[model samples]
Target: MKRFWNWNQDGDQRQLAISGVIAPDSWIHDNVSPQVFQDELNESQGPIDLWLNSPGGDCTAASQIYTMLMNYPNDVNVKISGIAASAASVIAMAGTTVSMAPSAMLMIHNPLTIVGGQEKDLDHAAQMLVETKEAIINAYELKTNLPREKISAMMDDETWMNVNKAIELGFADQMLGDDHQPTDCYSYSDKQSDLVVLNKLKRTSQNTISVKSLQKRLSLLSH
Candidate 1:
């Protein structure tokens, strides 16, 4: 069986890299089980630096990993090196401090599951999904402190965030650098309004703009 997580000793800190789909060995036949991961984590020494890059897979596996990390005695700092999407985003919330590379991406969306049965079974599945989404919201809320309503809406929209947006929304604490911090140049109560302005600038400039530049342009527009 292949391991989903890789652990390497780096001086006083242990570096853990979590890449690819998250699933139990029984499901994938080649993926590491959560218990196996727990065993490795239990044996580790010093603080952990976790590097995440996954498209997400089983929610149950993610929840187990998240719980394990949350319960670990040492600090676990998560660094998003590529993308953390869907169930992987939930696991990312276990970090004591989360950081993202400048071009890394973070995505969140409503939970989905397949059901096969009669109408009653379908109804039960729907309820399960709803409850599952709320559980995911709990993780995001704990990390970002964003309102549940907003987080739900964003999930409904299948929100995708770049490093700047992740930091702005508190999904990530900072950019990966010695002096990087969350961008605070602009704030908007309405996400739609923010998107409109961002879309307008994208069209006008025919390119992406930095948060600082966006702030300057927004200020000019207000004046």
Candidate 2:
């Protein structure tokens, strides 16, 4: 697996880019293990600018990263430059100042599991999933302060939020960087191919194009 954290030094400005899947082997090549993340976080000090572009993975792994960030005795600002979905959204909750690029997306959903076993085994798995869902909700509740029922309903629907909605819903705190500039371009895994259709990027100052618009454009392409 490729190491996901690295220093990007531009003159005196430094930042760590968390720019892919959250857990080991989420994709065939790029994955971040908890050990790898811990090692990187420990080696780095002072103020950190964390740039996120992830579709999320491995809730336990994300939770560990979130805890580590929260415990670090330094200012850590999170900037979502592309997409922060699932477990990635959970990690973003740790930011002292969480921000989203204009075109970035944030998604949240109930815990998911795939299982096939005896009835008792299935029952146990279901119970575990329920506990995990609650834990995930706890992170959102702490960050958003929205009613638990509302949050739960959104999660149940696998809701997708763009930059404005993310901030409005309390998933993010601010809009980061130059507003005129285009958000960073990223590629989702083939697993997400069915959801994201590849389209040539189109941007304009007259209108702010969003992920939802891109999805609609892609949907049109498919038909």
Candidate 3:
């Protein structure tokens, strides 16, 4: 069987399924290129069901996919079967109707990058990042009327939202399939708490090593 998100149009709905992770060499960029996306859009007889479960990769590639979906004439329904994080969430917002399985998740975060350059080069990279972020924010805003500040905060925190939470935040228009609740909803506070515990353990281990070093020094001095 063909993998999901690889531009397989042999489904029941005569709808194309775009599923799986998003990366430069991923199905979106390799198997389903821009031409393929245009062909699919031109030939689609009905609504397109986009199943997203990806950590997200390749901002440029994801942007291409997002643009194609947004330009499609037919209705585009995005179903979050597992998780849509990072750039994957940008594509999801392009769907005319966004829904999520009761057990599925959606994550939104600011675009991140690593750069090494002089001050001027770094400034240019920073500007590009800002533009990219604004583009993503515009897409989300178009889909849901949520305030920019709210969306910005959520993205800054790398917020994870379950079905109900997604609906409440306007990330998802509805919930599909099952009527189950998510295991637990986490906020930035929860992440911080976990980090605190981890830091405490590290500090305790360091103190133990320091005491051992002091003991060895005292023994040597006595000798």
lDDT of 1 at 117: 98
lDDT of 3: 0.67
What TM-score, over all chains together, does every model reach?
0.78, 0.72, 0.70
By summed lDDT, the worst window of 10 consecutive residues in model 3 runs over 182-191
Q: Tell me the deviation in Å of residue 42 in model 3.
A: 2.3
User: Model 1 — TM-score against the truth?
Assistant: 0.78
lDDT of 3 by residue, 1-223 (tens): 2333545565556455555655546443365465655675677556677778887776776788788876665567788888888888888877766678878888888998789989998999999899988888887775655678878888889899888777666677667763342213322233223322332232334445553464455456556
Clashes of 2: 0
**Candidates 2 and 3 compared by TM-score, better number:** 2
Clashing pairs in 2: none
Off by over 4 Å in 1: 24-32, 178-223
| lDDT for position 60 in model 2 | 78
